[model samples]
Target: MTFKHSIKTALGGLHSNTSRSILTILGIVIGITAIMLVLSLGAGAQNLILSQIQGMGSKTIVTVPGRQPSGPSDFANVFLDSLKERDLQSIRNKANVPFAEDVMPVVFGSVRLSYQNETYQSTVLGGGSAESNNVMSDIFDIYPEQGSFFTASDVLSKASVAVIGDKIREKLFGDIDPIGKKVRVKDKTFQVIGVLGRKGQVSFFNFDDMILVPYTTAGQYLLGRKYFDRIIVSAVSEETIRTTVNDIEMTLRANHGITDPEKDDFFVETQADLADRLKTITTALTLFLSGVAGISLFVGGVGIMNIMLVSVTERTREIGLRKAVGATNSDILTQFLFEAVLLTSLGGLIGITLGSSLSFIISFIISKFALASWSFSFPYLGAGLGLLVSAFVGLVFGLYPARKASQKAPIDALRYE
Candidate 1:
């Protein structure tokens, strides 16, 4: 028989066993669906993370007061008391860090904010100098919508002035003009000077839920710590990021009297470094989950093989009649192989469609409810790979059944009950 006729015979055979064929492909459909979902979500997560990290500009560097975290369990080391005022000052010195364009010491704490009877728990960020106000404004890409930022005098005098987020304004002030109002923080009351515009999240920090104050005041009064939690530095240009990092590290090491790099207490992370680390983590997680989902495909392949074997046995009398009527063994093998491949390939296509539709729906829900930045990405590569894998599985598993069906003697197959 011709190849076309072989394929036609294969379709007729599958159509006769429609229920069994559908059941056989179910595992393949599920496996491909899971893989597609993982790949699509993984791509979206990576994009969001990289975008957030790079949004701050490639020239940005963060100096934290602890050894570099190697894993999740070492996160507590990030809060270690290492970066002090002297380290901040040294980083700011032009001679010590020539490439450093801007440097600010950041100290933050969660505190209770009160305006008369209304009270809310909010995070307070402290940092900014006469020179650093515009610097922060540039770095965070935020400006006050209603009022103005505090003056240089505020940082120097440790003044009780506060700049609240837009959300804070809505909750506490309710349409009332927040500027020039007094908000209490513990025993200290700060006069509201400015309200940041509706900037939701900047470089992983949510500006909409935070309050900004002077670092000196926060260090002495709010957090009651003299050391800075983090020191932010920006380079003059993207090309100078490495130079600035090296300079900041050398300056801090000198201030701390450390000669060995491995023994250093603090860690410095540039924008590129952070992005690479996060990308690696995301990619690794994606691969791990994808591997787990792959187990289902193996099970699906086994199901297909078993079903095909059973199909050969059930069609034994037909196979004998065909072989007796001019059908060659090669033709019989091609027909059975085609049946297996068509079943798996059809399953792959259905799986791709279902997986993509589900992925899009999930992405929409996540973007609407959880993270506004989350987005959907079609996994074209994954779809292609899934299809290829499915075809390969069919080819490999179908070979044994096809060979068994082809090797049957015409008289013996006819005699089988």
Candidate 2:
């Protein structure tokens, strides 16, 4: 009888039933804290959506405006009035393919900007040329801490000139200096030349609550019409992203006259198809929350097989005084399989430290805004898969109650009572 005296007589029979070994290790500590808080909140929401899609410029390529998928009101009538400007001059005559510098055409809405009396509603867009502010300075890398971003003759003279963003210059010039201020917006005004810089935020896109303007004052006085919902191109390198997406899909399928390419309406997409659609939606939500944390480790291995069948019916006279003192049958089946693998490896090390502190409090509420930074270590591959599957589910449910308390015997367990 030695594997350290059968683990100090199976931890002195679990400290003489300390509240039934803490209620049979509360289902392996709630199935290893719900599979380590669903694999650390699905690997911190796919590392904060691949760091906000590589901070919005993963070799950018977007295009939108694709309808007739047969429904959803054909993507709301291709978002009303289906994309135009000769399909943005068939993406600027596929600007002779390869490393085709920039290409624009955006169009957007949501108004109410104001100033004196500080209004703030937001979102305004418009853009195009001044190489769409170098594709919004490589998708919000930065530029304009306060003035100047419009020119391609200020979008060919529709100039009311604008650029604002750092949260609409702190809700209309707070720390003052919003260039040569003027604000207003749909009701017309404008002027605040520039102020972007601080670009933070992605999912729920808040590159500092926008404003921009220009594409001819969003096609004459805020969307009077002249359609365009998306288009932002940009290549200049990355080895001419597949010959600039096959010359902007063969110059928008020969300027929308569409000689087939699935009846071309428009709809490109790249960055390796947005990182395989966000790693197939974070690997199907981390295998559906690790199959609901493997049903709480299969209900904590059926509560360690019903407390090792009520510890072989309350230790029949201590297995007949350890088989009348000679102690054999593999030392009472290794003291009830080392007291059900030391109570499910101390309930899988306190459910991997309370599931890695609930995936670091949901990655500190999404790193307050710069997105993704969720952590989850303690994965010695989930602590060697919770110590070899909670000690092989306590040696297969304490092996038929430790082989029925080592095959009964020393005279029917000293005539069990």
Candidate 1: lDDT of 349?
A: 91
- In candidate 2, which residue ranges exceed 4 Å CA deviation? 1-12, 16-38, 43-61, 64-87, 91-154, 158-160, 167-174, 177-206, 209-276, 279-281, 284-320, 325-338, 360-362, 365-392, 396-417
Kindly give the stretch of ten consecutive residues in candidate 2 with the minimal lDDT sum: 370-379
- For residues 1-417, write the lDDT of model 2, one tens digit per residue: 668889999999889888888888787778778777776677666666677667657667777777535446566445345578776765666444546567777778787888888787878878757544465665546577766688777787788888877877876777888888787786888888788877666533565787877776777797687887777677876777777877887777776677877666766776667767778878788778777777767777777778778778778888888789899888998898899888888888888787788777766765654453444334457656866777787788778888888888878878878
State how far residue 31 of model 2 sits from its true place (Å).
11
Score candidate 1 by lDDT.
0.88
Question: After TM-score superposition, what is the CA distance of residue 178 in candidate 2 from its true location, in Å?
Answer: 1.6
Q: How does residue 190 of candidate 2 score in lDDT? A: 80
Query: Relative to the unseen true structure, what is the Cα RMSD of model 1?
Result: 2.0
Quote the lDDT for 111 in model 2.
79
Q: After TM-score superposition, what is the CA distance of residue 338 in candidate 2 from its true location, in Å?
A: 8.7
